[model samples]
Target: MKDGKRFPVVEENYRFECTLCGNCCTGDQRVWLNPADLMRMALFLGYGHTSELFRQNVVLLDEGENGAWRPRILFKSYKKLRFCPFLENHLDDRGRITGLCRLHPKYKPLICRLAPLGRVWDAETGSEQWLFVKPAPDCPGVNSSRLNSLRETLQQYGSEIEEETAFLKKLQHFLEMKSEPEAYQELFYFIVKRKGEGDKR
Candidate 1:
């Protein structure tokens, strides 16, 4: 429970399997990225700097909540289409236009790796709970015969998820201590310097 309210928590036996229909890649869904994500993407693309990543593929989203506004980093969709920039569409054997992500299976953002499931953690209590990210009505990956445990899903990222989670907790704490503008600048430089120091793992 958070703020004296209970949230629906997903169980361990939650089952899901991606059919790779590409529905998730076609929407205006925002895939927020952490510093770790930036590092991975930079390493994958062989870029020494992240400025081009922002200029080409990512954007600073002006997110607001409860009269508070902050700049969060997330991927940008194509200018003409409301789909991921990396998303490719091609006709399958069945004559269906299937969506394929160039960065899938590896180099994907953490949220993309944990699609259909989202986590909420309390900074004070250090407790985390998983919730179902509402999928599209016709999404075929919701409940399939192939079962996947929540632990297994998270384990797909191995130790990276743990590191990302820890970093997020610390970042959240830092944000609360500083003003929005200060926090944004600090966060940007921290990510650049932290990743620039050969922290790619």
Candidate 2:
């Protein structure tokens, strides 16, 4: 049952928990970094600015409307399997993954804090919404205190959540309009024109 305070508790029984399995941090998961995340990562790495770090490590995935570009950092891999560049699989003398991140805790991205949670937009209203997902089937924290922790983390980054929601809405709108090229071109022009007007202010 949802605490019924922060997020709308859906039919699915939700809980908070992380087993430190590191499964969520690895693989082809779309790890999109935002401006705030870039700043945090740079500060953590003792770099004066994120520009240098971004220029060297990030690759542009796609171009969005108004010249916005989506970039992702490449991960280092030993063999065919790719891991999160910030993840360290080694254990201490006690043999624990320890949930330690190579990037400073402050620098971790919005997605990092909101793991097991996803954002979507309602087609009818064009409003954004959030949904929680189980990190893994084997995760013991599926319906426990871990859920609460995740919610708290999300609350702390409320602004980022809203921004993400807006981005999702725009992306969805773009995709839906793509099927109608003429309509899409018109809409794109309208948005660009409005953005240009806003920049003048």
What is the lDDT of every predicted structure here?
0.65, 0.56
Residue-level lDDT of model 2, residues 27-110, one tens digit each, is: 655576654565566556665545555456642244444333444556666777676778766676778765456763566777
Model 1, total clashes: 0
Residue range 39-155, candidate 1, lDDT tens digits: 667666776655556555454535443222333445444566576666778898999888788777677777788877777766678887787664555788876887768877777
Assess every candidate by TM-score: 0.77, 0.61
Q: Which residue ranges in model 1 land beyond 4 Å of their true spot? A: 1-8, 64-80, 135-137, 189-201
- Best candidate according to lDDT: 1
